[model samples]
Target chain A: MAGGGNLVVTVSPHIKSPETTGSIMRLVLLGLLPATLWACVLFGISGIAVIAISVITALFCEVTWHNLRDGKGTGRTWFALVSSLVVPIGVSAAGLGRAAPAAAIALMSAFILSEAGISRQGERRHSFDGSAAVTGLLLALVLPPLVPWWIPFVGAFIAIWLGKEIFGGLGYNVFNPALVARAILVLSWPAHLTAGWFRSLGIDATSKATPLMLAKTGAAADLTAYYAPLLLNNPGGCIGEVSAFLLLVGGAMLLWKRVITWEIPVTYLGAMAVASVLMGVDPVFHLLAGGAVLGAVFMATDYVTSPVSSRGKIVFGIMCGAITMLLRVYSKAPEGVTSAILFMNMVTPLIDRSTMPRPFGVVRAGRGVRK
Target chain B: MRVRLIDLTRGLVQENPLLRLMIGLCSALAVSVKVENTIFMGLAVIFVLTLSNIVISAIRPVTPDNIRIPIFLVVVSSFVTIVDLVLKAYFPEVYARLGVWIPLIVVNCIILGRAEAFAYRNGILASTLDGLGMGAGYTLVLIVMGIVRELLGTGSITMMGVTLISLGTGFQAPTFMITFPGAFLTFGLIMGALNKAQSALAERAARRATGSAGRPTPVGGV
Candidate 1:
């Protein structure tokens, strides 16, 4: 397995594993499936449409970039295209009740045409695997369903371009691409991103404030009503963030598969719970509201952006939760999960540096040298 | 004469103050939200820079080197006061928008930098040309940035109370483009584009000089 890598001559007792980047990414995608599908089911056609556009656009960008650069496409690129195209259409048609299927078909067709136009200049094949699709899916899940169609298109492009590629792609990215895109979009159009929230299940399809917003305004009197529907996945919030239960389920799948460890998420939620209690709010309600669960499970534990050492990861999570609560309680913005996670992403390297373990049998010299 | 012309033209691109030399950015970024304000600011800079350059160059031969900086400050402040009074009297709207940035021009690094770096060593004519060139370059960038910020931030471009272009009712403008961070983003992106374009031109020249079938680098590789 290590044969393909640059072999650095080191001390003996070498170990190797068959796990590759593509394999890990596929598992991550599998873990995300439940929450994504639930979001589509609750938000209906528009939710699916957003996810479809994002995923296809992401894959299209990756493949087009490679094709233009290398003049050939890889096997994984074709697989990514087919999967990004087929999965969203199938999920939307099956889950979305009584909405026109034509919209999905038209979107997919247009995307295909775009992909064809992009790849026509090259004769070579490229590989996309599932990383871009995962980023696209995650980005869609965090966005409000009431946003205009073009928002996702623009967001996905920026996510892939600025968030991922500009940092030299995949393992090199400092921030989670989806969160970066969301942050940029939110900053660019606060009215569109933060104001327009659709009720879940398309039940009135009317725009309403998320529970976090209500909490911020102190308008949510019935705290029980706010916490009751957390499991039902029918609340006023971003498409996937509404369902705390489903997000937990997906997170558990990742934990069970060992795609992600429990350190970051556990510490993150624990710290958030403590902060909520300290702030005189119900801990469980705080845990369930906004994007706390989604961000704790998905964004904070990102392999590239999160701290590598276990101790560092715990500190990172605690800081993220604390900053998130501080912003929620004291800042003007109603929610702070995205910004909090991004802030932590920036500090992960510093955390890792501080927490690095000392080498065996090594000792430091005395405090000061003689002048 | 050709060397002097190069000195005059170099500031336009080869050594642009804001984008390349990176001086006088405090006023440039702050007052670039409106085209009218930027024009006034640019003209003020040109006036102050040119006059200060001429004064510094004329005094360099007679004055002691130790007190040159204080002398430069006095000359620059005198010219800045003139600009201040003129704008306050004639273009109060632009002056009002510009506010403290106009007075802060006395401390603007470009004016003093030209005095200390170029004017103190060169003749009066050459120093004046250098100041005009640098000021023109700064003004060009200000106008370009003003157009971008105003057009995107407010969906319309207005100059002296006249609407030059309006995106109309259907367009949704991003207000971030006129904010402080937006100014940095605009400057950074334009600078990056200029760097890339210049490097591409250099590579093409290198290829021409080589006169061989060298492997061609792809466009926009960076």
Candidate 2:
């Protein structure tokens, strides 16, 4: 056998980094494990069931989509499966409701079928990468537990087809697919999607109004009761939302592994903190009670959606935080993170274009146009 | 007389106000949500476009070139007022559904655009044909968009309270298809498809013209 026939091809920017796409994805999966495990401990068998169903459905969808689109099946199906499972499982573990499992399955199936159906009869089959599953999972995590299952399916379809495929697929998308799905779902079903709040384990679980909701309706509730539990990781919310501590830990791990940068999450959370302080609201409560931490760190800071440069990421984060706070306090809805992220996603191209790093030893010209 | 027919037919494809010129998009996007609203708006536009064009063309010779813009506005506004009043008095239901958009037609760029571009230069007969063609084109686009949006948004198509098509039991509208963003996406997609079709047709025509000349081929002389 000729050695040249079996030779592997590689390209530069050949300066090697330790990370591979699979490694980065695996790190993200690892970062999510703590919150997922915590959710399981709190929510019990329903949580486990949802995770199983979501993962299975996501994998099935990915395989089916790949087979239909590419006319041949390949590897990476398992990764897609796991990524999809994470969202519904995360939501269910946070106590979305009994419908979580069924909804996840339906959405996964529909997303796969629709994507497959839309492709031409004899195009090269698209890869069954883990991206769609990851998007579905992230969207599930941000959504309220009480959302009708069909909503996620629509979100997944929009996120995958419109947000991702319309711009070409996966890495080409300017925004996070998960955040896109979550935004559409929230906007479409504000009443059902934003209402429910399930408490954490060993906490006095009650159907009390969320702090953001209370702020919106001008109906004040006892602040200490809500604030303390949330700070200590005991507040009621979506699966990953209950534990600010765990999310931070995961975020830190992501930063340490160089899986994500410090600019977006740091600026976003800092802005939220500053804004909360300036508004004279409990800063701790604002950070802990809603999807702010999870969104800022995990969803908004998605590599595809967030800004490319360090400074751009910082500006993007601050904008997201400020908008999230404003919407939470002044708008009709309880959560604003998803919308803020999606809105920021739309402007990412502009941000990247304006803030591209200057070439080495080059003199800059006059001020550029503003978006 | 022959030139007038070309001017009239141009609006059907070459100068389609909605797809080609991208004029009057606000009402086009908003009212295209329902087949009924689209039809109503389309007919209203036709009436307004024709009347405004004829009136503008009749007064074109006397109207000063410097003040033509304002004079065109006045003509368009008067026609819009007439439409608004008539609709309010007779078709109260459509009047209510159309709401402020009917009055907004006075300022619609399509009306003003035609008044300045075509009606001001052409004779009354030519202007009338141009107006009719443009109105017909606008109506066709609106109806197509309305059918698409209504069918997708509600999972059914209804015209004047009669259901033309339904997706059957357990089928519900996406709801977003009727909202603002949906309107943008739908308009964008339709515009894109229109552009694609137009280009493809042009390419085919160019290819046939080029192929015949370059090859020195005789048709039916094989």
For residues A180-268, write the lDDT of model 2, one tens digit per residue: 66655555565656665555464654555655566456564666677666654554566567577887898899999888998898899
Per-model TM against the reference: 0.84, 0.80
The candidate that wins on DockQ is 1
RMSD of 1: 6.2
Residues A160-181, candidate 1, lDDT per residue (tens digit)?
Answer: 8778876667889989999989
Tell me, by TM-score, which candidate is best: 1
Clashes of 2: 6
Chain A TM-score for each of the predictions: 0.81, 0.77
Q: Which stretches of candidate 2 lie over 4 Å from their true place?
A: A1-12, A16-22, A44-126, A196-202, A214-220, A227-235, A366-371, B3-6, B123-126, B151-169, B195-222
Docking class of 1: medium
Clashing pairs in 2: A69-A125, A70-A125, A87-A137, A96-A145, A198-A236, A199-A236
Candidate 2 lDDT (Cα, whole model)? 0.74
